[model samples]
Target: MTNVVTCFLRHRTAVLLGRRSDAVGTYTGRWAGISGYVEGDPADAERDARREVREETGRTDATLVRAGDPVDIEDDGREWTVHPFLFEVDSREVTPNEEIAVHEWVSPPAIRERETVPGLWAVYAAVAPTVETVASDDTHGAAWISVRALEVLRDRAAVADDEAAVASVARALRDARPSMAAVANRVNRVMSGGDRTPGTVRDRAAAAAEAALDADDAAAATAAERCGVSVVTLSQSGTVRAALDRARPAVLIGESRPAREGTDVAASLADAELDVTLTTEAALPAELAARAPDSVLVGADAVLADGSVVNKVGTRGLALAAAREDVPVYVVAAAAKVRPDEAVHGETGDTAALYDGAAPVSVANPIFDRTPADLVTGVVTERGVLDTEGIRAVAAEHRERAEWDGGLEGAGTVSG
Candidate 1:
């Protein structure tokens, strides 16, 4: 199979190249992008890209920008698909990875003169304009301008016109708001319910439902139409699961382990005629990786104050792998997933014990695992896709709101 290469170029320059190792391959000793094979596991791609980048440049702090489509190339009878990505880093800090015999930052004109690998040049040409636009915008004293550049590339590649694209972006933004809000409300309800507060389970469920439906039918329909892929959710939390279901993606439920709560989700989703995949946790990563899914939708058991997330143990590996691969990973839990008290206590737990009755064997199980905020591309709540800072702000807001409402009286507390 042709490997997928993440072509990392200098932010505004032509492309970054690295000398290949002595191993046999196309363009050996010639410069190449940060490349790797597309693994059956979605996490492999992301991991490979990061590894390659570090390997090629010896920099750990590089922030990668998602570039456009994959470009196909063939060398010595072996074909490869190159996925272009851009990153801006302090050039002074670059150190060549051991595999790299040499490195150079070549300009577009210089790129033309080199015995550049075939297919790669075209890919670079396609993405060069976008990178240049971003660079120019940055030089002109513009506010953070990466997204606008991405918008440009997205527009150029789009088959639809401006209006369609705008509408699509609008609908996604619109749907995300209420979905996140529903998540927040559900969490609040659960916390409140545990304390025997005024709200009942039905009330919380209703609040969640309302958040899911806040957008008009037309907007919701548009979003569903625009999103190209189906997302199966594996969560036991009702409010969260329901919120995800109402988002209109084709969702399937895996029988959640231990309690087998996923059975309930599967039955419900099946009744709705949604294509459901019922499987155990061990099978989830392989299943998802095999499908080469667009994204993975799951909930968090807890999110630390520092923005690290704690979800089910199985979820951590799945998420890390997904993040490693180029696939976008989203944690669709509500603001309630944020554990306000985690700061006072360090966050660490045994996750192996969630399974039933193997008491004779020592099983250390903690209900959650920490997922660094960076690993998460976005947090989809009834509110929307919140960045790391946005998530922190929202979590703080919820804490304040809960305290003001006397909503924290009897809640269980755990320190991070």
Candidate 2:
């Protein structure tokens, strides 16, 4: 029997299972999702999730919705840990495989009662939802909902008055117009696509913030004026650039190597009237340690649930330096940047370019580094300033409503 790994796959209404072929060995008749080991790849978790869906069910059109924590199990005296990934597939396309002798499309409770494998059972429980299924199909649809509409519905449901539902609908209608406008503008920017290199993501983000202000000048100006300095080890986002213009705080921009995104940040800050200082990546620690600014803000490419931050190569060191100096480091991020998919990826950049072709250069230029939760004092959102715990709370709230209201549709509702 070949050594085989097993995973239980689930969709909105049913769990997938497979009966192993006799030649495959262990648990020849046992049902399971597609599972295999790919050695030496750190992206195993993502790869496994995709592979399982395609191999077992012939559903290659699914995207990973989330990756849960790992579960350890022992079978036949061998111990293995399975990393479960929650995926949304078209329920309509599900068909039993030849290896799957008999399949069941049971509700969550029924699956819990019948699943035989301990590891697969645990994964099912973790991903199961309590709410009734709203829609089901052979293929899973994209999880898209306007943030504003969801908020209005939730708010109405929370109230205890006859007018609650009416208020909610009214508010949703009022907000939806602007929300759609914002999305349209962003879509236009992408469609027009002029100089949209990788560097332009930041530029686009900043431009969006600036454009948001046209609807309400006072609020936009206020957001633009919030006092916070981004001690960026790389380039600042268009959003951050707009904020700096209004806030006008001193910036400590670091010359992050190869990319030199910091040069871009410094130049932008200078253009915005913020007192800008350029320094080497290594100098960030000393510069922040020397004095306390109103706050040290940085942009994140991605963020983990435990509040670890992933940014440019030198971010972790800079965050550490800030922590030691009693300085608060705030991470500026959009909801889209929050990656609850898997363990934070720490690798950031090409090592060769990071070292500038130096001899004996074995440099690690992770495009994103992890900033532990303790070091991050707060998060600045279009909504407002949130401390570490507060950020988690807000995120939790978002997660709870993610399915029904959609993720961060009323994100602008929190805007200054």
Candidate 3:
């Protein structure tokens, strides 16, 4: 049996694909990812994958995101096994070696159209997100999940006939993460729009994905205006990191418990040259009182019509601490995060995450919590600082988007 490794280098929404040269390859002129034979112990498959990426692309700065189980396939009567790995490369620049005759970065789904090596799409599928993977992801933020939701909608839109299957996908995405209102809102905007044909749904989903990404950047920019000289925050929001990058504030971060996501965020911010202080969730109140930062800038998973914010479990406590210290708390998120009502169903994590020991005591680990509106000083969005009234107004607009609900009222309008 032949053993090989396939590496997929992704930059943002696109993945790198190389066209094979005519010199020495069996699949000459065929589109493929960076791949090579796997040698040594099977556990060293990732090591070999990275080596191939470095050798083929002439770059050594790729970071591994995920790896898939080895896949078995038969190509032209040759039995083989493929180990797949996905990496995130910061830059699109690739100095292709002789193995690749030409290289181009493109959206992942576009790879299916070209004539390629056997099982290339299947290999790619092993490492990419499916509707199930997107629904189950717990480490990413709401904005990130929302964009992925749009991706799920777009990728699955054209896979069926009645397009009712696509509508079901949209609903599944909407309910995937109950705490992530941004995902539901973005999907609602795309599905509620006129025309529900597969083509229209796919195009609309693509457009919504772009707009959601842009809205995140714009919201970050708006939040940067109020970031102040000193700020305290918790959890890990890509938008919050972007805002911090723009302002360069002296930051204090609390390690969001269970997952301790803020510890990772602190390292990233510090790497970006920002002065950062890391603290524990239990000691955050003391740190806030002693340091007295100018603002508590946090990110939101959802903003309710009454102006309350839903975020990571520690966020409410952070806001409460900030309130007591006379520090203003600013919630930064896109306006689309605001929902018409406070329909909440927060997910709980594995009890093993909190207590995996042989203790008689029980453990509860809720993944999120809602912070009261009164505790938040203001909500900053892509549009600007929104007052309570402004938030409610946006909610009212979202309320009108219920035209597509229940039994697929607009399911018939799907794209062809």
Candidate 4:
């Protein structure tokens, strides 16, 4: 069987699609991913995939998200096996080679509407996050996981017209990150709040992803307005990053441990023209006493019913430090982050991530901690600073939407 690699280059919410030129050997004038024949070791398909992206799109920096298993297809008197790769790029700019006549970045689900080679959607299915991937992901925040959840719905919608897949994917996504209000809240919104057959859910999922991104950006803008000139923060939250980029305040940050995400956060703000100080997660009291900031700003994994914030493990200490220093604490998060749940789910990190040494010390690496609402001065969202009552009102609305059953029950796996 002949081997080839199809690389899907993705930006923020959309993916790159190109129309093949007449000069191309096969499927000329049809839309396809950046692709080329795998001329070397099949195991080097990833190397070949990146090379192909560089050749076709002139993007040498495309980061691979996942590589899918080979898909066999019989087409045009040839036996073909296609290798799939998905990549994320920071910029949307591309300079296509002779292979493509025109290129456009479109939602992955929109591929369903395009005329293309056989198994195009199937190729995407391999590289994209499955229900299992979304369920087991422990490295990202709620907002990021929520987008991947919508992407799961998007891919399922692209593959079939089965409403069962929609409900199944939605239910799976809600449970994937139980502590994440955004994942469940947003998925439930699409499943119940929208016209959600498989065909329709694709567009709705795409639109909802866009809305979530916008809400985060708007929420960041609101928080930026409230940020004091001196701020103490932790963790690498996209919403926090956006707000800090806007505020450019003096920052005293702690390493959000088990992962030194705070270092990355500081590096990300290198161009923001802000003064920064980085300390260990355990040095909260010393750091706060040494450099008392005006506010302790953080991003939430989930905002509980009473406005309590669930965030990185170091956040409770940070908030307590801020309180002792008589500084106010502000939480920046999208409105969807407010969940109906009153109790925070404890998620422990991998023991290997904490300690793999021969010592018999048991490691309990709780990934997050809750900061009481009484200690929080304000909860900033896209709607501006919400009072305790405002936060509770939003949580109640989500509680109403929490029930996964809109009307369809017994939405098991898709069966023929």
Collision count for each candidate, in order = 26, 25, 8, 0
Which 10-residue window in model 4 sums to the lowest lDDT? 407-416
How would you order the candidates by lDDT, starting with the best?
Answer: 3, 4, 1, 2
**lDDT top scorer:** 3
Models, CA RMSD each:
22.0, 19.2, 4.7, 4.9
- The TM-score that candidate 1 achieves is 0.41
User: Taking the tens digit of each residue's C-alpha lDDT, what string does model 3 give over 157-249?
Assistant: 745465688788888888777677788888889989868888789778887887888899999998998989999999889899899999999
Task: Write the number of the candidate with greater lDDT, choosing between 1 and 3.
Answer: 3
Give the winner by TM-score: 1 or 4.
Answer: 4
Residue 257 lDDT, candidate 1, scale 0-100 = 53
Write the residue-wise lDDT of candidate 4 on 1-416 in tens digits.
98999999989788899999988888888899998899999888998898889999999888788888998988778887999999999889999998899999998877778998767877877888878888887556778778889888877777655888677778878777777779888887787664667878887888888899889989999998877788888887889888888888998888788777888787767646679888888886678878777777899988888878888888888788888889889999998999776667777778898789998989878888888888899989998899889988998877777654752223222100
Error of 2 at 192 (Å): 26
Whole-model alpha-carbon lDDT for candidate 2: 0.49
Give residue 213's error in model 2 in angstroms.
9.6
Please provide, for model 2 over 1-416, each residue's C-alpha lDDT reduced to its tens digit, 9 standing for 90 to 100.
Answer: 12223444544334465555564445666555566554435346677566656766778777565466666778788777666666666454665455566565543333334435546666554443211111121011011212212222322222324433433443343233321222222223322334333224223423433333332233224344445554433444444554566667777778776567678768766776777989888787888777566666666645555676666568788888877777766666544334332244333356656566647867765454567777876555555555556556644543443333233343322110
User: Over 4 Å off in model 2, which ranges?
Assistant: 1-234, 354-362, 387-416
Residue 148, model 4, lDDT: 85
lDDT, candidate 3, at 218: 96
TM-score of each: 0.41, 0.41, 0.91, 0.89
In candidate 4, list every pair of residues with a backbone clash.
none
Clashes of 1: 26
